[model samples]
Target chain A: MKLHTYFRSSASYRVRIALQLKGLPYEYLPVHLVRGEHKAPAYASHVGDALVPSLETDDGHWLTQSMAIMEYLDETHAAHPLLPADALGRAHVRALAQMVACEIHPLNNLRVLKYLVHELKVSDEAKTGWYAHWARSGLEAFERQLALLDAERKAGGLPPSVFCWGDVPGMAECCLVPQVFNAQRFAVNLDGLPRLMEVVERCNAMPAFQSAHPSACPDAQ
Target chain B: MKLHTYFRSSASYRVRIALQLKGLPYEYLPVHLVRGEHKAPAYASHVGDALVPSLETDDGHWLTQSMAIMEYLDETHAAHPLLPADALGRAHVRALAQMVACEIHPLNNLRVLKYLVHELKVSDEAKTGWYAHWARSGLEAFERQLALLDAERKAGGLPPSVFCWGDVPGMAECCLVPQVFNAQRFAVNLDGLPRLMEVVERCNAMPAFQSAHPSACPDAQ
Candidate 1:
């Protein structure tokens, strides 16, 4: 398998962490989003929209979108399953993952940031404000979710683990690592989100997440 | 079962259509997003983030995110399965679904639009421009995906159907209808997307899609 990725791309970071967690090795092919390498025809053919972190399977089929690609990897590999064994648990994990993917990260991604500066002609200060607004609000919601989950577990007399679900890191970890990285980059206030930041620290300490960090990627400048 | 939803929410519309497709009866409880009813303590207690289209199961679990809620419904009530049985096919269906859910819909949702105008103080012309830019670019990518799928099917000597996956409408259809409705409302110029529009037309002719449309909601006015 091969993955087309970019060093600073959050979505690309998500797929890398998932691959690492599953103990799956794939050739890393960098798609330079900053340099417009993704717009090349060869890459565009592989990923219809020229999105990064597209996985080309051994059988030659390509998959796009980090969540969908992660799900595909989980389905085909199935060793260290990213989702839970049961239906309800899977829904909870998915909901947590989407909170990061859909609500927070999408609004503050590279393209949207660039759009604020260039297309909308917003000043850098205001651009940063926009970033912090979405990031902080989204993380507040995430913090609430973690609190709710912990309360439920405590109510059932179950001990809490460092990971989002049980003792194993899964889809939510894949999402949280990249998001926390982005949050710190823009200096989004992390003071109110102690629980979420703790999970982020736990995830980053793992060898899998350490290896998948953007600084460790071949395309890191 | 009860669904917390708003009349014009694209995400809410997706789950409603899924429930209709599965032939399940669910009581609709309107959460007026514009009126800030989602932030009410009771509603917020049920959904941590106060997002709409939250499904309360008969067993008392509240599921959030349209995709996750739909998956839960599909898992618990399995008469009309939304995803394909095979892993690869399921991956394809999910990729298409996320193209709408993750890419297009997030940028144009009511909150984001409100942010663009109220917070950024963007001129109406530029705000509309921002909306069109993201919506059109995302849809173009989606159209390219459909074309690729069609080419692959033809190469495999498989016949094409009116729906995204096959003869039946499923998750992708749930996402596509709402997106197309919003596109037409914004005058995003759907002329270039004949294949997607054709699928949209076919889906709208179905009772499930028709009944789940925004106009059919009790608080649609």
Candidate 2:
């Protein structure tokens, strides 16, 4: 397997963590996002979408979209599953993931940021403000969700655990760490998110999460 | 089950179609997006993310994110499955879905549109151009994928199918309809996508799809 990835892409980072967690050995084919490599004719011909973290399977099947690619990997190699076994639990995990993937991350992506500066002619300060606004607002909602889960557990509605769903750090944690990282980058306050912060700290200590950090990758500045 | 939805929200429309297709009866608790009812204290108290299309089950479980909600409904009510039984097929369907959900829809969403107009102060013409650009580019990619599938079938690589996968629309068509609707709204060209257009036409002919349309909803202008 080979992954077309940009080191600093949060979506790519999520896939890397999933690969590491599953103990999958794959070649990393770096596509430098900063250099417009993702939009290059050669790479775009294969993926068609011109998006990074496109995984080419051993059988020559190319997969795009970080969440889709991650789910594909989880389904194909189920040793350490990223989703829970049951239906409701899986839904909760996915909802947590999408809260970041769809609602937050897309708004703050490199392309969108570039559009703000180049196309919209927004000042750097305004662009950064936009980034921080989303980071703070999105993460606050996530923090509330975590609190709700805890409260539900206290009221015997959900099971008590260290992770988002239960014992293991599944898709939710995979998404959470990246958003938290982005939050820290934007200097968003983490004051009322102790539980979320604790989970991030725990996940970051793991080798899978540690190895997937943007700064640890070869392509990072 | 009850769905907390904004009628014009593409995400909400996806889930509404899924529910209708599955023959499930769901009460629509309309949250007016234009009036900012989604952010009302009452609604926001229940929803952690303050996003629409929150599905509340008889069991009192609230499901957020249209994709996650659709998957949950598919899992619990197995009469009409929204995803393929096999992992590879599921991956293919999901990748197609995310091509719209993650890539196209996010860029043209209400918030993004508002950002373009209010924050960036882009002229209506330029904003329309931006919308058309993403819609056209995204549909072009979708058309290419469909064409690739057609070629594969001719070469005996894949079986002939009425829908994106086989038989049912699955994840791909769920996303495709709204996108095509938006594309047409922006007057994006549809010359090269006969297969996609055919699929869209077939889907629109269905009662479920028709009833779930933006115009059929209570909040439609």
Candidate 3:
């Protein structure tokens, strides 16, 4: 297996965590997005979308979309599952994941940030403000989501844990870690988001999550 | 099941089609996004994320995120499955679906558009340009993705079909229709993309897609 990755790409970082969690060994083929290497003909021919984190499976199937890639790994590997066994639990985890993947990261990706500075010509203050806007609101909503889950668990007389769902770090953590990394990078004031911050801290302590951090990546500057 | 929906929301439209396709009868509880009903105190209390297209399941669980909700419906009500049976096929379907759901819809949604126009004070022309920019490139990538699939299937001696993955109109179609609608609404020229438009047209011909359209909704103003 091979993964096309960029060290600082949150989406790529997500796939790395999933690979580590599943214990799937893959050769990391770095595609430097900052150098426009992703758009280069060599890389573009392999992954038509020109996106980082396209995983080429052992059977030689190339997959794009980080969430889809993560799910694929889980389905194939099956040792440590990313999603829960039951339907409803899977929905719960997926919803938490999408709250970050869809609502948060899409707005703050490198291309969108570049657009704000280049095409829109927004001030440095406003550019960072946009990042802070999505990060703060997204983290707040995420914290509230955890609170809602905690409330449900309390009502059901279940004990709380460090992970987002049940006793494991799964899909939500794959999403949560990178997002919190971005949040801190932009100095988003996550002061009141204790639950969210706690989950990030817990996931960061785990070897799978720790090894996938941007600073630990081979391409990290 | 009862769906909290905004008529013109692409995300909402995706779930509406999923419900209709599965033959699930649900009361359409309209949330007027234009009127800020999704962010209303009442709605926020029920759905912590305060997003539309949340499905209150038969067991009274509120599901947010259209992709998550659709997957839940697929898992619980298995009369008609949205994803492919095999692991690789499921991954393919999900990747196609996420290509649109994650990449295109998030950028052009109401709140982001509002932020671009109201907060950033971008010109009306630039706002529309932003919409077309993501839509055009996204749709083009989608078409290329389908083309990539076609190439693979051809190599495997598999026959072609109208939908993204196979013979059925499933997850990808659910996402594709809404995105094409948005593209056309924003006046993006989709002429060169034949394969994508054909799928959209085929999906439109189906009663499920037709009934879930924005105009069919009670609050479509």
DockQ of the two-chain complex in candidate 2:
0.68
- Considering DockQ, which of the candidate structures 1 and 2 is the better prediction for this target? 1
B64-166 per-residue lDDT for model 3 (tens digits): 8999999999988987789989887888889889889888888998899999988899999999888988888988888888898888777777888668878
The parts of candidate 2 lying over 4 Å away from their true place are A186-189, B152-156
Candidate 3 C-alpha error for residue A51, in Å:
0.5
Task: Report lDDT (CA) for all predictions.
Answer: 0.87, 0.84, 0.88
lDDT of 1 at A174: 91
Interface RMSD of each: 1.0, 1.5, 1.0
Q: Return whichever of 2 and 3 wins on lDDT.
A: 3
lDDT tens per residue, model 3, A103-191: 99999999999989998899999999899998888888888888887876677677885588788989989999999998888888989
Per-residue CA lDDT of model 1 for B1-221, tens digit only, reads 99999989999999999999999999999999999999989899767678988988887778888998888888888788988787777787888888888888888998999998998888999988888988888888988888887777777677885588777888888898898899888888777888888899998988988889999999999
In order, what fnat does every candidate score?
A: 0.67, 0.64, 0.65
Descending-DockQ candidate ranking: 1, 3, 2
Which number leads on DockQ? 1
Task: Report the CA-based lDDT of candidate 1 relative to the real structure.
Answer: 0.87
lDDT agreement of model 3 with the native: 0.88
Q: Which model, 2 or 3, shows the larger TM-score?
A: 3
lDDT of 2 by residue, A143-162 (tens): 78777666756676566878
* Model 2 C-alpha lDDT versus the unseen true structure: 0.84
Q: Is the docking of candidate 3 incorrect, acceptable, medium or high quality?
A: medium
